[model samples]
Every structure is written in C-alpha cells, then in structure tokens.
Target: MIRFQHISLMRGTKTLLENADATLNPGEKIGLIGANGAGKSSLFGMLRGELHADQGEIDFPSRWRLAYVAQETPALDRAAIEYAIDGDVHLRHLQQQLAEAESAPATAANGSLIAELHGALADADAYTVRSRAEQLLTGLGFTLDQMQLPVASFSGGWRMRLNLAQALMCPSDLLLLDEPTNHLDLDAIIWLEDWLKRYAGTLIIISHDRDFLDGVVNVILQIDEQKLKRYSGNYSAFERQRAAQLTLAQSMLEKQTRQRAHLQSFIDRFKAKATKARQAQSRIKALAKMEELAPLRAAAEFSFEFRDPVSAPNPLMVLDDVDAGYRIEDSKGTIGKKIVSGINFSLQSGQRIGLLGVNGAGKSTFIKTIAGDLPPLSGKLHTGKGLVIGYFAQHQVEMLWHDESPLWHLVKIAPDTREQELRNFLGSFNFPGNMVTSPIAPFSGGEKARLALALIVWQRPNLLLLDEPTNHLDLETREALTMALAQFEGTLVLVSHDRHLLRATTDQFMIVADGKLQPFDGDLDDYRDWLFKTKLVAKSLNAEPSPPAVSERRNAPADTPVADNSNRREQKRFEAQDRQRISALKKPVETRIKRLEEQLAKRNARKDELDAQLAAPEIYDAANKETLKTLLTEQAYCAKEIEQLEHEWLEQQEALEKIS
Candidate 1:
C-alpha cells in the first residue's frame, strides 16, 4: 500500500500537484490521465523517488521493488532476449555474484556464498527466464528469428517494444507503464492488454487510449487544477458517473426554468380573464419556488466542430484497379513491387470508412494514394474537380514549423482570415489565452495533435483522410474529435487502432490485407472473431494465411465460401487435418500443465503450513519476532510466484483451447 498525505509537488516553476491526498491499495490498476502538460509523468517520477514532494509525505515500504519502462535503449550488441532478461535486476545481480564466487577456490566461504546466491536466484525465478523473455518478445510482435539478433539491429519503434518487454520481464511490487501502446499495432496492443490483465502487482499506467484503459484499469487518477483526484471505475464508468452528476445538477436549474415558463404562461392566459388575481398569486409562489434550486454554473465541455464543406463532391475519388504502394526507382527509373493490388475503391460524399488490418498491411499506402500524397503504381486514379482534402497523419504534426505558435500555424494556412476568428477556432480545441501564442515546439504530443486538427478544420475540407488522428489525444479530446467527425458533412477515411474512435466515427470498414483493399462487411465484433481464428490458425500452422482473391473481395463476408458440397467437403477435410495436428500438439502442453499443477499444489501446501504456523499466537512472542517476519515475507513471495505461474498456466490453456 502507498499513501500520499496532503502532497504538493512542482516541476521547475510550474505546480504539478498541490495539496493532493490519495491512497493506492494493493493490486489496484490505475489509469493516470489528464490533458497534455497536466503532469502525469511527474507523478510517476515522484513514485520512483526521482522527484520529491515539496510538502507532505509519501509513505510506502522502502524495500518495495518498482518496475518502469526505460525511455532510451543503448545500441547494444547483445541479443534482444538477453537484454530483456537483464531487466530482472535481482536475478542478474545474483547470477553475477554467483559467477564470481564460483570462479574462486572451493573454500567454505566461497561455497556458502555460491549456495546463498543460487537460493536467491531460485527465489527470483531465474530459471526459464530466457523462455519467458522470448514469450514477451513474441507478444510484442517480434518473430523468433529476431529474438537472437542484436538489439542494435532494430529500429526505434522496435526498440521501444524491447523496452516494454524488458519492463514486463522484471519482478516488481509496483509496475509503472507510460504510453506502452504508442508504438504497438492493434494485434500487439491486444496481446499487451492480456498481459497487463494477468499482472498481479499494483499497476499505474499513463495512456490516452480509452479502450485500452477500460480493458486494463479499474480506477482513474486524474490531474486537474494543480491537484490529483481519484475516480472509481474504468474510463467509461468514470465518464458515465461524471455525466450523470453533471446532468442532475443541470436538470435542477432546467426544472426551475421550465416551472417559471409554466407560471408565466398561466399568468398570461388568465391576465384578462376572471381568474387574473388567482393566476398572479400562483405565479408569484411558483417564482419563489425557484430559489430552492441552486444555480448551475458548471463549465461547458471544451469541443470543436467541423464546418460544412463549401461544395460537396458527389464522388470524391475513384481508384480503378489501383496498385497502391511506394514505387522503387533507380537510375533506370523502373517501378518495383506494389503493396496493395486491384484496389477498386470509391469514396462518395458523406461516407465514413474505417481501415482495418494488421500492421504493415498497406492501409497507409491506400490512404496516401487517395490523398494524392503518393501515386498509384499501375492503375487509373481519378479525383473529382475541386476536391479538397484535409489529410491528417502523425507526420502532419511534424510538418508544422517547430518555432511557430498555434495561432501562427493557422495564419499560415489562412492568411486572409481574421486573427480573432482563428483564435476563436483554436480556443474551441483548448488552445486559449497564452497557449495561442506559446510555441507548439514545447507542447506535448496531445496538444500538438489538437492543433493539427484545428488547422485541418480551418479549410472546410470535403474529404478528411485521417491516419491515427487520435494517437496522442486524451479522452476529452478524443470525444470532441469523435463528435466532430460524426457530425462532419464530408467523406471520411480513417486508419486508427483506437476502437472507440472507430465505432463512433466510421459507418463502414475496409480491410487491407494480402495485397487487396476490400470492404469488410462485418462489425467490430465479427472482425475480432475472425482475427482470433486467424491467429490461432497461424499459430497452429506456423505460417500466415493469404487474403481472399481480388475477384472474391467484396459484397460478402471474407470467410464465406460458395454454398456447394465440393467446398464443404474440402473445408471439412482441412478442419479434420487441423484437429489431428492440434491433438498431437496438445500432448506436450497437457504434460506441462500437469507438472505445473503438481508444483502449484506443493507450493500451496507449504503456504498452508506457514499460514497455520503464523496463525499460532506463540509465533508472535517477542523471542519469535524475527521468525514471524521471515514467515510473512516468505508467504508474500510465495503468493506472487504462484500467481505468475497460474498466469502462465492459463496462457497455455488458452492456446490449447484455441486449437480445439
């Protein structure tokens, strides 16, 4: 358990937290969230002991181990799995100590030291650490071939994944994850959510992804007005609770206003009639009744609205047999391989389509082709006359002048537009007062994203091509964007890992896979089902299945086969083969499961023995104080080890069941 009593903290000259009181219980998974610059990472620093509170005290056991993802990775020549295993500081230290002891002569002193080190390593679960590290790497989307490669061989994004795997590899009482999904694709994100769900330690994660937060966290710690506030439940629950409170308060004032209108109408109706005096008396009483209801002074939600396009294009673009992807050019100027082929996509006015597929499946390539940022490799691409596109991608945020303010960036987009109008628009996106002039270079990723959207809305585009627009946006900003996109009177094509955003904005979905771009005639639920089956098949066969052919791509479910006896017979034959292969595979898994069950039983029995011994009043005697402490410590350690083993056991069970 951890407690903060009337804590206040600062970063440089800015107050990050002031007079905030909160307590975090054991095994609580908390989502630390706020708008950009609200000091989420600062609070993490305080917990890790790098940042001290200006006032008040933070109370926690000094021996509590904390695990956090490293922001930077060295260009090491070490194997990736070896680097991940190195995160287990205790295990690594014990190994090094044991190695030194074993190098010395086999004296009594050396022997005892070696034995103690070996015991510590066993307690830390050092055995099979390499296999565990490899599992983490695989979950994060690294292939087995990449596990033994040098860490220096991977790119920055892959390095981030390595860092996350390393952080998860470490044993800790508390785990801190900061935007762990930023570098992950949808599949990897799903895998990570499962991993986090199984983590028994207290988890504090900072992320802008609402869906991810809802899946992993049970509580929210929000930073606002220089204070940290705790809210019960997941992100959606918090939103609902907050909304209900706001509604009730506003409804009181609305009720009074409606009563006032009713009274006035009665008075007006009876003013010239025989009941004039009675009506006036009733009106006065009703007006007095209004005093009981408090005034509703709640601040309005900060949101932005996209303006209607000046001209609506019936068909925004037409891709006829398009081959979308980057073309390789050399001295000979010859075009090379295409990523997506036979893409017969048509974007009509008011169409909202969400792009879906695994990472590197050419979703971005198709989007770039439609946006005219990239030309098709070998097909006719036609655009309607006077087509205006508001293309929003992560790279667009980077394209802005680093030294410019939000106001300055807007001015560059619309030079003739009034400055006040631009300021008003930026204010709607939460860039108000000094923020309008502050250099965006110093802004957080979320703030920059908001500004980028603000710039896009200024042009009143007829079509919006957005690729992960909600990547760094907070819940409020994401909601605002969702509302805006839902109401936008234009064609929209979005590529996002944020499912909440996709559900809110997109009316249809398109899957980019196996070199084809086609409609996905199913909702998110069905897509998930297909995804699970696809992964299971790939795992069983040790290879990826190809996508449907171009001719069979549209107007039906992707998994559907023609209703014929021949196809049915072929499907049944393949299914039979899969079942036979799976049954053979399950033998080893079942054997391992049985062994783990036996080990768990033994551990539980020992724990019960300790529990009974600790329950005895004689164990608490003054002479047995050290004995009591040892038993308690060992009990806690045993519980954690068992919990981890149970989690591993479940994963294996799931794999076996997926095949079945």
Candidate 2:
C-alpha cells in the first residue's frame, strides 16, 4: 500500500493540495480525475519524484518499479521498435553485459562472466523483447512497416504513441498514464482499454474520456477541494457515489440552516422579557455553540448553446459519386490519390452523424472533403443554397492568437457587437472576469478548445463539422458540448473517439474503411464487434498455410469431380441462407433489447427525480408526509422495474450475441 500522511503540496505560491491523506492498495487500477488545473498532473509529478510535498510525508515500497509516459520524445535515428525495447532498462543492461563478455579474450574469468550474463539474459527474456515491443506498438496503432522506421521519421502525434508504447513496454509494479487516449482513434482506444484491463499492476490514469476510464479503472481518485478523495469502482460508480454525497451534504446544510434560523428568531423575540430572559439566554448560548455549516459551493459549470442558423436548406450538401482525397501537385503535373472513393452522401438539415474508423482509415479525409478544406478528386459536390459550415479541428485551436484575449477573438468575429455583450457570452463558456481579458498564451489545452468552440457557436452555421472536438476538454466541458450538440438545430458530422459523446449526440454512424465510405448497420457496441471480427479475418488471411496431411495427400484422386464447382456454389448458397435465417431470428430480440433499454432509462430517470425530492428537507416535513410516502413508494417501484428491465435487456443481448 502507498500512504500519504497529512500531505500538503504547493506549486510556488498556490496550494494544490492541503492536508490530503489517502492510501492506494497494490494492483488497484485508479482513475485520477479532476477539473482542468485541479492538480491531477501535479499529483502524478509528486509520485514520480519530480515534485515534493511541502509538508508531511508519502510512503510506499521503495523497491517498487514505476513507469510513466515521457512528455517529450527526443528525435533520434533509432528504430521505433528498438526505442520501445529500451524501456526495459534491466533487460538492455543484461544484453549489454552479455555482448561485452562474449567479445572479451577467452579465459576462465571471461568464460564465467559470459555464462552468468547468458543466464541473466535468459531470465530477463531479452530475446523476446522485440516481439513484445512490436505488440505494444501495434496496439498503439503503429503499422508493422512503421515500427522499423527511425523515431525521427514520425510526426508529433505518432511520436507520442511511441512514448506510450515505451511506457507500456517497461516491466513495472506501478504504472501512471495521463490522457493515454488523447491521440488515439476509437479503434486504438478500445485496444488500450483491453490492454489496461489485463495489466497486473497498480495503475493510475488521468483522462477526460469517460468511457475509457469506465472500461479500464476499478477505483477513482478524485482531486477536489484540495483533497484526494477515493471512491470504489469505475467512473460511473464514482459519479453515483459522488451524487449521493452531494445530496446528503445539501440536505444536512438545509436542515442546519432551518435550525439556526429558528433559534435566532426565538432569541430575538424573547430576550427582552423578564420571564423568558433566562430561556432566551440559554437559547442564545445554544445558538452560539451550534457549528456553522458552510454552503456547498459547486464548481462553475460551462453551458452554451448554438445560436440558430440564419438559414437552413433542406439538403445542406450532396456528394454525387465523389472521390474524397488529396490532390498533390508536382513539377510534372497535378496528381490525385483517392483515400475514399465513390462516396454518395447527402447532408440533410438536422442530421446527426458519427464517423467511425481506425487511424489512417480516411475518416479525416472524408470530413475534410465535406468541410471544403479539400476539393474532391472526382465527381460533383452540390451545395444547398444559404449553406453555412462551422468546421472545427485541432488546427482551429492552434489558429487562436496566443497574444489575444478571449474577448478579442470574439470581437474579431462579431466586430460590431458590444464589448460587454461579448464578455457576457464568453462567461457562459466559463471565461469570466480577468480570464476574458487575459492573454490566452498561458491557457491550457482545455481552455483553448473551449475558446475554439465558443468561436464556432458564435458563427451559427447551418452545418457543423467537428473532428475530435473533445480531445483536450475536461468531463464537464465535454458534457456541456454533448448537450449543446444534442440540442443544436442543424446538421452535424462528428469524428471523435469519445464514445459517450458519440452515443449521446449522434443518431447515426458511418464507417470509413478500405477506401470506401458506407453507413454502419449498428451502434458503437456493434462497431466494436465488427472491429474484432475484421482483425480476426485479417490475421487468419495473413497466417502461414499448413502442409497437407500425408494420408490426405495419398487419398487424393487423380481426376477432378465434374460437379465440384456446382457443389461449392451450392454450399455458399446454403451458408448465405443460414446467415439470413440467423439475422431474421435476431431482429425481434434486438427490438426487445432496445425497448427494454428505453424503459430502463425512463425508470432510472424517475428514480432520480424521486431521489432529488427525497433529498429536500421540506419533503420530510409533517405537512408533506403523504407526499414523501408516495415518492418513496414510487422510488421503490422504479427500482424493481429497472432491475427487471435490465435483466431482460441482458438476456436479449445474450440471445443476439449467440445468434451472431
């Protein structure tokens, strides 16, 4: 176990944590979460010994090996695989010793040293280090060919993947990852989730991706109110527990407030009377002894909505037999390379779409073409009248002038708008007071992303194209964006790895793969299954063929059967029929599952309403006893119904899986 005994940490003049104490058990997967600038990374720094506590102490097993992703990767000519292999410092040292021993002059001492080194290498499993490194790279979305390239050849994002691979490659008792999925696509994020689930060590992660944390971590360590608060279970569980705590705290505060008011009123009314003077004084003493309950101060929430577009055409845009890709011009002539071809898509008003694909699978190319950032290589693209597009990507965040204030950026776009109005608008996005006027150079990535989004909302475009908009946002901001997108009265095309955002905001999905774009037949869960099956098929196709058995070879006929082709065709037909049959059987089960899920959601919502009512002090008053009783009865009923519905949902899902 790792223990923090009254730990207080400071970053210069600002206190990040004060009198914080927590214990982390071995092999616990902890999700370290907090708002932006809430000291998540600082806590990690303290654990890594790059920062120290200003008071008290932190104690853990000194011998435990710790591994964390490096913030920067030096440009080097070393092969990517070799760089990952270097993460295992002990194995590399052993290999070096073995090489040096073998190269020395032959002697008894040298021979003994060589033998010992060989044994050490074998124990370290140094020979298989390359293969393990390759697996790590592959899981992180690196292709086989790219693994052999020099580290300096890759771009900045790929370099970050390499750094993550290196950290994963190391053998450690404790692992710390900060936003590991930030640079990953959906496919890579899923892979990392599975990998982290199987990791048999103490793991701590800081991530804004809620689904990723829910799928990987078993415990949540939140940095709130300058303290380290630990909660059992995953992100969802933490949310439930935190909500309960907040409800209870608010209830207690309200009750205390009423008690204090009542006592004060009594003392005020009777303190001057002779008969009630003693009683009033006694009441005043009681009031003075009463502990003051501070009001619960919730974090400032970010909330904004997309202003209605000036005009919305029926069909915002249309791509007729379009080839989406880049056009490269050389000295010879212009050349077009198709990334995704034959895309016949229509962007209708109020359509919400989520784009799904692995890394380098043309998702960006497709989005860029729609955003008019790139001209189609071929085919006609028809735009509806009064079409206005608000496109957001990482580049938009980067395009913000670092020297300018948030107010200044808004003013540039809405030049004629009053300064006070612009400032008020910025406040809705959580940029208030000095933050609105301060230079954004010192802003965090989350701040930059929020600013970029604020600029987009100001445009009020009829069609919005957002690519990974939640990349640098915290959970609160992401939720705000989700709500905004859900309520936006316009067409939306989003490419993101945040599953929660995708599920909540998009009503349909399209997949980009194999140089083709098409509608995905199912939801995110189905997409996960599709990815798994696709990988399996690819692996089997790439696997080496085994030799024929000797007996089978001997039994082979010299002459071919004349009906062989017909028989094979008949077999394929039967297989197709079987697939159709299974699909037919699955349809009703899927429908039931969907219906059950809807019921569960409704019941859960009602239960939440009941819970909120129960938390209010007035609900428990004598006059409202009947109402309180009714609420409790409904809450109980909702709970039972939810349980039954969930069970049915699970059964239907299992049936569908079995059919598949």
Candidate 3:
C-alpha cells in the first residue's frame, strides 16, 4: 500500500499538487490523467522516490520493488532479449554470485557457498529469465528475428517498445508506465492491454488515450485544480461522475450569483436614505465579507467548430482503377511502388468513412493519395469541380513553425482577417491572450495538435482526410474534436487506432489492406471481431473466403431495398452448411459424453452398495476389520474415478459449447 498524507508539491513557483492526499492499494491498475501541464509525470517521480513532497509525507513499504520504463534507451550492442533480461537486476546479481562461487577453489567453504547460491538462483527462477524476457518482447510486437537483433538496430518507436519490454520483464510490486501505447498500433496495444490485465502487481499508467485507459485501468486519478482526486472505475465512468459534479458546481455558482445580485439591488435602493441607512450599511458590510463562489470553469474550453464547405458535392471524388503508393528514387530512374492496387472508392457529401487495416497495410498511403499529398502510382483519380481537401496527419503538427505563434499561423490562412476575429478563433482552441502570441516551441504535443486542428478548421475544407489525428490529444480535446467532426457538414475519411473516435465520427468503413481497397459492410463491433478472426484483413476481398452465415445476414445486399431473393438463397445455403458442420463435430463429443456418464453411473452405484455394507454395525468389529478396510478402499477408488470422469465430461461440454 502507498499513502500520500497532506502532500503539498511544487516545482519552482508552480504548485502541481497542493495539500492533496490519495491512497493506492496493492494490485490496482490506475490511470493518471490530466491536461498537458498538470504534473502527472511529477506525481510519478514522487512515487519513484526521485522527488519528494515539499510539505507532507509519502509513505510506502521500503522493501517493495518498483519498475518503470526508461524515458530513453541507450544504443547498446547487446541483443534485445538480453537487454530486456537485464531488467531483472536481482536475478542477474544472483546468477553472477553463483557463477563466482562455482569458479572459486574447491574447498568445504566454497562448496557450501556454491550450494547456497544455487538455491538462491532456483528461488529467483533465474533459469527461466531468458524465456520470460522473450515472452515480454513477443507480447510487445517484437518478432523472433527482431528479438535476437541488437538493441541499437531498431528505430526510435521500436526502441521504446524494447524499453517497455524491459520494464515488464522486471519483477515488481508497483509498475509505472507513461503513455505506453503512444508508439503502438491497435494490434500491439490490444496485446499489451491483455498482458497488463493478467498482471498481479499494481500498475500506474499515464496515457491520454481514453480507450486504452478504459480497457486497462480500474481506477482513475485525475489531476484537477492542483488536486489529485481518485475516481473509482474506468475513464468513461470518471467522465460521467465528473460531469455530474460540474453540473452541481455550476448550479451552486448560479445560485450564489443570484443572491449577490439581489442583495446589491436592495443596497443600492436604500443606502442613501436615513431610515434604511443602517440596514443598507449592514447589508453592504455583509456583501463585502461574503465568500464569493468561483465561476465554473466552463465545461470545455477546447470546443471549436469546423467551417462549413462552400459547395458540398455528392461523389466528391472517384478513384477509377487507381493504385496508391509512393515514387522512389532508383539509380536507373524514378520508380513507383504501388502499396494498394486495384482500388475503387467514391466519397459522397456527408459520408464519413473510417479506414481499417493493420499498421503498415497502406492505410496512410490510401489517405495520402486521397489528400493529393501523393499522386496515384498507376491509375486516374477524378475530383469534382468543387472538391476541397483538408488533410490532418500526425506529421502536420511537426510542420508548424516552432518560433511562430498560433496567431501568426492563422493570419497566414486569412491574411485580411481582423485581429479580433483571429483572437476569437484562437480562443476557441483555448489559445487566449498571451498564449496566442507565445511561440509554439514551448507547446506540448497536445497543444501542437490542437493548433494544427484549429488551422485545418480555418481553411473550410469540404473533405477531411485525417490520419491518426487524435494521437497526442487529451480526453477533453479529443471529445471536443469528435463532437466537431460529428457536426461538420463535410465528407470524412479517417484512419486512426482510436476506436472511440472511429465509432463516434464514421458512418461507414472502408478497408485498406493487402494492396487493395474495399467497403467494409459492418459496424465497429464487427470490425473488432473481424480483426480478431483475420489479422487486419491480410488478404484482398476476393482472395479471402466468404464470411460466416451470421456475417452474410448482416451483410445482406445493399443494392436491394430488402434482401434480394438470390441473397436470401445464398444465406440459407450457408446456414444449412453451418448446421451440417456443427452437427458433424457434435456427434463424436456427444458419444464420448454418454460413455463417461455410463462409467460414472456404474462407479457411483458400486460405491453406494459398498457404503451400505460399510455402514453395518458389525463392520467396525475386529472380525470384520478386513472387510471394512476393503470397502473403504473400494469406495475411495470409486469416488476418484467418478471425479475424473466428471472432469472429462466438463471438458467435452465446454468444447461443444464453444463450437455452438
């Protein structure tokens, strides 16, 4: 258990936490969330013992081991697996001591030391350390070949994964992870979430990704108004609880304002008259000393609306046999590599399509092609006369001038705009007053992302092509953006790992996978199930086999008002075939179950007869002692056999249930 008692924390002149207290119990997975500058990292530092509370005590068991991902991983020549294994410093130390003891000169003392070291090694399970490290690496999306490669060989993101693997490899009572899913794709994020769910130790993760938090964390510690308040439940639950609190606070504030205004009116009407002067004076004094209620922090400052498009054209763009990819520089000449070929898509006005695929399955490429960021590698793409594209990618934030302010950026978009208009627009994005003039160099990733989004909305683009736009945004900003996109009267094509965003904004889904593109006639839940069955639609539509009967019904022909007769016929055929397959699989299992039941019944009957004989009073007599022992042994054997058969029957039943 960890306790923070009357904790007052400060960094320089800013107070991150003031007189806050929280109690974190063992084995609880907690999410530490706040705005960009709200000091989540500072709290983590205090927990790690690298920083101390200025005014209160943080008490925890000193013997408890702590583990956390290193912000940076050194470029080492050691194998990635070995680097991960190094996280278990205690196990490594024990192994080193054991090696030393074994290498020492042969003597009674040395032998004794070696024996003790071996026992310690066994206790630590030092022999399985390598396997455990490998498992962590694999769970973190490292391939077998990648695990054997040197730690220096991987890219920055992969190196971050290595750091995570190392942290997870370490044995600890408390584990701290900061934005562990930032560099992960949906697949890897799911894998890490499942692994963390099974972890027995306490986990404290700081992440802006709401879905990830909802999936893993059981508790939420929100940093609000310089106080760390613990909320029981996931992120969604926290939002509901917080919203209720804000509503109550707003009501209180309104009531206080009304009371103050009514009192002031009475004081003004009577203060100058002699008869009411004393009462008015007393009212004035009371008003002066009254504790005023602070105005509510308006539910969201990040809310901003995207400008409506000038002309909303149906079938905004059409890709006629287009191949989406990049042009590469070769020694001979420039060459084009088509990432997704044989693609056909049309974006109509008010159509919001969520793109689904694996991390490297040409999602970004397709989006880039649509945005005209990259030209089609092979075929032609026809655009409507009034088409306007608004592209927001993760890299767009990096393109912002570090020295220039948001005001300057917006001014470039609207050179003739008035200063007040510009200020109002920036204020919608929470960039008011000095923040509008402040250089973006000091801005956090979330701030930069918000600025980028503000710029996009300023352009009034009709078609939005956003690729991972919610990468660094906090929950409030994300919700604001989601709301903005939902209300935008524009066509949307988005590729993101955030399921909540996908579910909220997209009306339809288009899959970009296996060098091809096609419509996904399903909802977000179906997409998740498909992702589980098929590893991100690894094959082209025609190449892969047809879906199951249930899928066929859900995917009934879109061209027909009702299911066409032929479609119904096909669905019925598939259903029949499914039943046949299920029945074939069930027969043998049912036969085995019947046999187990028969054996159990016979054993139980024999045991009952033996029990009856053993219950006879003469069975306890010395003359019948042998009979009693035999009866007892037989009964024990019968009971054990029945239990074993029942276990087998259960296994068979579970298997059949899964099939059904």
- The lDDT values for all models are 0.82, 0.84, 0.81
Best of the candidates, TM-score: 2
Model 1 C-alpha lDDT per residue in residues 1-660, reported as the tens digit of each score: 889888898888988889988888999999998867788888889899888889988898788889999999999999998999989988888888988877887665555565566567667777567768877887788888999999999999899999998899999989999999888877688878878999999999998888999999999988877777788999989888868977997988788788888888887777677758776877777777667666765665668789889998779888899888886778989775799999887788889999988877888888888888888888899888879999997467777787989999989889999989888888878898999998889888778888889889989999999998877777778888999999998989998878888999998988888888877877776676566656654554466644433332232333667589897776676666656755765765677678778889988998899889988999866666547656766776677667777876886688678646
Q: Number of clashes in every candidate structure?
A: 0, 0, 0
Q: Give me the displacement of residue 414 in model 3, in angstroms.
A: 4.4
* Predicted candidate 2 versus true structure: per-residue lDDT over 247-357, tens digit per residue: 998999999999999999999999999999999999999999998987899757777899999999989999999999988899989999999999898888899999988
Clashing pairs in 2: none
Return the candidate ranking by lDDT, descending.
2, 1, 3
> Which sections of candidate 3 miss by over 4 Å?
99-135, 252-295, 298-300, 330-335, 411-424, 533-572, 576-660
Better of 2 and 3 by TM-score: 2
TM-score, prediction 2: 0.82
In Å, residue 153's CA in model 2 sits off its true spot by 1.2
Given candidate 2, what's the lDDT at residue 132? Answer: 71
Models ranked on TM-score: 2, 3, 1
